[model samples]
Target: MSSDRLRMYLFSSMLAAVTAIFAQIEIPLPLVPISGQTLAVGIAATILGSRYGAFSMVIYMMLGVIGLPVFAGFAGGAHIVAGPTGGYIVGFIAAAFFTGLFLEKTAFTYKMAIIANLIGMLVTLTFGTIWLKILLDLSWPAALAAGVTPFLAVGVIKALLAAWIGIAVRERLKSSQMSFGKAA
Candidate 1:
């Protein structure tokens, strides 16, 4: 493969690994614990943009499905993907894609990143809440209480952090001429 293509692959893989690491950081809750996976997803999108960002999330999900203890609480396997939190896990792909796409269409500034990450957060919550409702046979209110309401404040915080840190790192990478490819 060409050098740039190789770099892109490497960066995607690295972000996948980063997501795995971030998954280990969690705040235990009754139904769905808050985890760093979303934060990592935001960062991946902020730094890698649409195609590769989503690709990285796919890689992360595949690894977890293959029983790589990469999900929250070091849990993994297809069972996890089909479990209560599965929707959120699956949502990472769309979150990353849309988040990066937003940035790609706009600018990679901190303000734009914040907006994109917030959108990504909402996407994830929507997926998780719906899945939670379906799987647990819960009412909309219950599902929102269990899956979405609990995550709002923390999700915003994580989004802000992702935007700030991702932009800083992306800027540094750009300065070093090692941004993997385009301004992703």
Candidate 2:
């Protein structure tokens, strides 16, 4: 591979690792704990755009599936992905893809990132809520309560923080002429 492509792959791998680290930060809830995974997803998308961002999430999922302790509470394995939080984990892939796609189509500014992250947040919640409803045989209201309602405020906060940090870091990388930033 070309150096640029190598750099992109490396960065994608690094972001996956970062997501693993972020997963450790969580606030326990009844069904799903609020985690930094989504924030990491937003940041990955903002910094890497669609392709690499999604690649990172894929890497993360694969690691967890392979029994790596890369998920919340250091939990991992296929069972975890098949568990209550699995939908949210699966949603990370789509969230990163769409969030980066939005920024790629628009400007990678903080404002745009915020909007993209919001869209990503909704996408994740939708996936999780549906999965939760089906997995637990819960009513729509109960699913929403467990999967969506509790996350909105904190999600927004994380989105804003991700936007700010992502834009700042992206600009720095670009200014430094880093290969990953060029691809981003």
Candidate 3:
């Protein structure tokens, strides 16, 4: 691989590791525990943009599926990906990709990042709620209450914080003449 590709791969791997670490910091909820995973997902996209961000989440999922304990509460195995929260884990990929795609397509302003992250967050909630409903055999209302409502406030906070931190770090990197990608 070229130097740039190697750099991106390495960085993506690091983000994956970060996601795993965040996953371990879990607050036990009824079925799904709140974790720092989403925050890391947004941060990964902010730092890596669309392609690499997606790549990082893919790597993260792979690690979890392979029983690497890279998921929330250090619990990992193929079963995790096949359980009620499986859809949420899969949603992580979508969140990272779309969030990065929006930022990549826009001016990377705080406003734009927040919008992107919000959309990304919705994607996650939709996927996760639907999956949670199907997996747990519950009505839509139960799914929404169990999987969505409790998460909205915290999710918004995480997204905004990630956006702010990302913009600040990106600005610092740019000012220092550091390349955040192959093009730079």
Residue lDDT tens for model 1, 45-79: 99999899999999999999999999999998999
| Tens-digit lDDT track of model 3 for 50-118 | 889889999999999999999998889999999978998999999989999998888688999898888
Poorly placed runs, candidate 3 (over 4 Å): 181-184
lDDT of 3 at 37: 92
For lDDT, the strongest prediction is: 1
Q: Cα lDDT for residue 46, model 3?
A: 84
After superposition, candidate 1 runs with Cα above 4 Å error = 179-183
Q: Rank the candidates by lDDT, best first.
A: 1, 2, 3
Better TM-score candidate (1, 3): 1
TM-score of each: 0.97, 0.97, 0.94
Clashing pairs in 2: none
For model 2, residues 1-184, the per-residue Cα lDDT tens digits are 7888888889889999999999999999988999999999999999999899999999999999999999999999999999899999999999999999899889999999999999999999999999999999999999999999999999999999889988898899889887664535
